[model samples]
Target chain A: DTAVSQTPKYLVTQMGNDKSIKCEQNLGHDTMYWYKQDSKKFLKIMFSYNNKELIINETVPNRFSPKSPDKAHLNLHINSLELGDSAVYFCASSPKIVGVQYFGPGTRLTVT
Target chain B: AQSVTQPDIHITVSEGASLELRCNYSYGATPYLFWYVQSPGQGLQLLLKYFSGDTLVQGIKGFEAEFKRSQSSFNLRKPSVHWSDAAEYFCAVGARLNRDDKIIFGKGTRLHILP
Candidate 1:
């Protein structure tokens, strides 16, 4: 079984369009994270949620919001997408102790 | 703030050859280090991690890493390279200062294995 899973493996939308990516983890982990990998392959932590509480919010724009309904699910919603927002978005989960993180197949977002 | 650096952006190795990928980090206290691998069209996979105790840590797929506190480096090494090993490798650092102390990742090093 997939430990972590994300829906819509590929998303292509026009500028100003809003889209959401869903992530779920079956590992019974209490922490979930969203990371963005740009064209330069620079991976940056965008947000982190632990036990349904917002733990970390990076320097991402306000258009990006992360919602965690429960410990098992975390979703990312992006509004007014721009060309620069085109990149791969990854969802990962780890235990509360911050050990090895299990990641889901990334969702490639292309905003034209 | 903790950050990771992967000096080599790209590396090419022949199959059956030994491989070493360098990683460095800057932090005030002992940091939790990790090495992750990402294949094409896939999410990142944890190769190994070093939190404490012995400096040398072993990971899956015949991968290992040595942590050098003096040098503030954690380098991933493989005895023999395989064509399937070609992928992007990322080094990350985790801090304990905050509950949400997320893992900071390096830009990543792309490995190209020649058969």
Candidate 2:
């Protein structure tokens, strides 16, 4: 059983297009996060949600938004996507008591 | 802000050789440090974490990490290297907040194993 899973393992779109990546965790975790791994393989936090509430929002552009409907799900929506948006996105979940997070397989987004 | 740093960008080790990956963090208080490994086209997998108590913590796959408060470092080490161990390793610092917690990760160290 996969603890964390993300939809659209790969995404390819043109500039100015809008897309959404869905994430779900079956680990019964209270906190979920979204991360972006750039071409240089640098992983950076984008957003974090606890119990469906936005908690940590990094210095990301407004074009990128994360929405969590519940504790088990978090979705990322990007608007006006540009070529620079090309990267791998990973979703992770962790329990409140223990901060250890389990990550999803990741979604590779390529914007041309 | 809390952050983790990986000094080495890449490292090469021969099979059966010992290996160590360096990691450092900056925080005001005792930080929750972790080491995560990422195989090609796979998600990051937790190797070990240092929350409290003993400085040395053992993890899966014969991996271990020692947390040094004075140095503010958590270095991952293995007795012997396996070709299958080649992967990207990330060091992270988990910061607890009033409402939620967040983990800041390092750029990552790529390990290459030789036959």
Candidate 3:
């Protein structure tokens, strides 16, 4: 079984259009995270949720919001998306705070 | 703030050649460290990690890393390089972020295998 999965592996949308990326993990991990890889391939932590509680929110723009309905699912919603939003978004889950993280196949977002 | 650094942006090696990727981190305490690999159009995969105990940690795909506390480095080394191993390798440091912990990643080192 796929330990981690994400929906709409590739997303192409126009600027100003809102979109959402869904992530789910069957590993039963309590911590989930959202990371963004920019054009330069620099990976940065965007948001993190531990047991459905907002734990870490990096200096991400207000347009980006993460919603975790349960410990298994965490979705990212980008509003008023801009061209800079074009990047690969990855979702990861780990059982402990400092354990190895299992990552899902990222969703590549392209804002035209 | 804890951070990671991968000095080599790109590395190329012939098949069967030994490989070593450098990773350095800046943290006061003994930090949780990890090495991850990402292929084209794929998510990151954990190769290995070092939390404590033995400084030399073994990982899958015949890869291992040695944690040198004095150097603040956890470098990944492989006995032989395969074409399948060509990918972007990332080094990360686990640190506190607000109320929770966060894994800070370096820019990544792209590995190229030559036949």
Candidate 4:
């Protein structure tokens, strides 16, 4: 079984459209994170949640929001998506904060 | 603030040749270092990590990394390179006292293997 998984591997939407990506981990971790990888392949942290509590919030725009209903799931929702929002979004989870993390297949968002 | 630097944007090595990827990090205290590999359109896979006890740590797929506190460097090396080893390598650093538990990642170095 996959340790971590994400839905909608690819998404293409027009400007101003809203989209969401779902992530789940079967590792029973206490922390989960979301990261964005630009076309240059530069990865940046977007948000992190620990036990359903928000922890790290980077300089990402407000259009992106992460929701964690439980420790095993973290979902990202993008509102009014712009061309700049198009990138690969990755979901990761770790046993705790500041340790090895497990990543899921990324969701590629294409904005037109 | 903690940061990771992977000076090389891309590196090319012949198959069966030895390979080394340099990584340098800046942190106030002892840092948790990690090396991850990401294949095209795939997710990141942990190559190795160095927390404590050992300066040299072995990882999956015949990969290894050495951590040098004096130089603030944790470089990944392989005795031999294979075609499947071609991928993006990222070095990350995590501060032990960091409350938010965020790991700073390098821009990533793309590895190319020549046939």
Candidate 5:
């Protein structure tokens, strides 16, 4: 069983289009996060939701929005996707203690 | 502000040889350290973590790391390198304010395996 799962393992779209990535965790974790991995393999946290409440919001562009339907699900919606947005988007979850984060198979987005 | 640094951008090691990856962090308190490995086209997998107690922590894939508070460093080491171990390794630190605080990741180090 996958502890953390994400949809759309790969996404290819034209610039200026909007897309969304969904993530879920079955480990009963209360905290979910969104991270972006650029071509240089730098993983940076974009946003975090704790118990369905927005907690940490990095200096990411406003086009990226995170929505948490419940504690187990967090979805990221990006508007007016730019060429720079073509990166691997990863979703992760952690217990309240924030020990080791469980990551899902990243979604590789390509902007044309 | 807290941050993690992985000095070596890339490292190469022959198969069966020992490997070491250095990591340093800047934080005000006793920081929580972690090591994660990411294979090509895959997400990051936790290799090990150091919360407290023993300064040494063992992890999967025959990897281990030592937390040196005085040095403000947590270096990962493996007795022998495997070809499959050639991937990107990241060092992360957890925020101490909130247990669920976000994790700050380093730029990551790419390991090259020489067979």
Candidate 6:
């Protein structure tokens, strides 16, 4: 079984369009996180949810919002996407707040 | 603030050659360290981690890392390099706040293997 999975592996949308990326993990973890990797391969943490509660919100823009319906699922929604939003988004889950994180295959989003 | 730094952006090593990737962190207290490898068009995979005991920690794919408190460095090393090892390496630092956890990842170092 796939430990972690993300839907719509590749997303290509026009500027000003809104899109959402869904992530699900079957590792039965309590902590889930979202990360963005820019073209330069610089990975930065965006948000983290522990048991469906927001724990860390790194200086992400308001347009980007993360919603966790349950501990197993965390989805990212971006509004009025801009060119800068074109990057690979990854979802990770850890058993504990500071445990080893298991990452999904990643979703590549392109805003043109 | 906690931050991880990888000085070398890229490194090339011949096959069967010993390899080492440098990683440094800036934190007030002892921090949780990790080394992850990411192949092209793939997600990051944890190679090894250091929490407390044993400065030298072994990981999958014949990779190991040593944590040095004096220098705040956790460098990953391998006895021999394989072409499959050609990928991007990331060093990360995890810190526990009062009621939260924060993880910072370095920009990453790309590894290239030569025949």
**Candidate 2 lDDT by residue in tens digits, A22-75:** 999999998899999999989988998988988889899999999998899999
| Residue lDDT tens for model 4, B1-115 | 8999999999999999999999999988888999999999899999999999889999999999999989999999999999999999999999767568689999999999999
State the lDDT of candidate 1 residue by residue for A54-93, as single tens digits.
8889899999999999999999999999999999999999
As for candidate 4, its clashing pairs are none
> Which sections of candidate 4 miss by over 4 Å?
none
Give every collision pair in model 6: none
Per-candidate DockQ values are 0.77, 0.67, 0.77, 0.87, 0.68, 0.81
Residue-level lDDT of model 3, residues A1-112, one tens digit each, is 9999999899999999999999999998999999999988899889989899998899999999999999999999999999989999999999977578999999999999
Candidate 1, residue A65: the lDDT equals 95
Off by over 4 Å in 6: none
| lDDT string, candidate 4, A61-100, tens digits | 9999899999999999999999999899999999989889
Fnat for candidate 5 (0 to 1): 0.68
For each candidate in turn, the TM-score is 0.97, 0.97, 0.97, 0.98, 0.97, 0.98
CAPRI level of candidate 2: medium
**Docking quality band of candidate 3, CAPRI definitions:** medium
Using DockQ as the measure, which candidate wins? 4
i-RMS for every candidate (Å) is 1.3, 2.0, 1.5, 0.9, 1.9, 0.9
Displacement of residue B56 (Cα, Å) in model 1 is 0.9
Q: Fill in the DockQ of model 5.
A: 0.68
**Candidate 2 ranges with C-alpha deviation above 4 Å:** none
Cα displacement (angstroms), candidate 6, residue B18, comes to 0.3
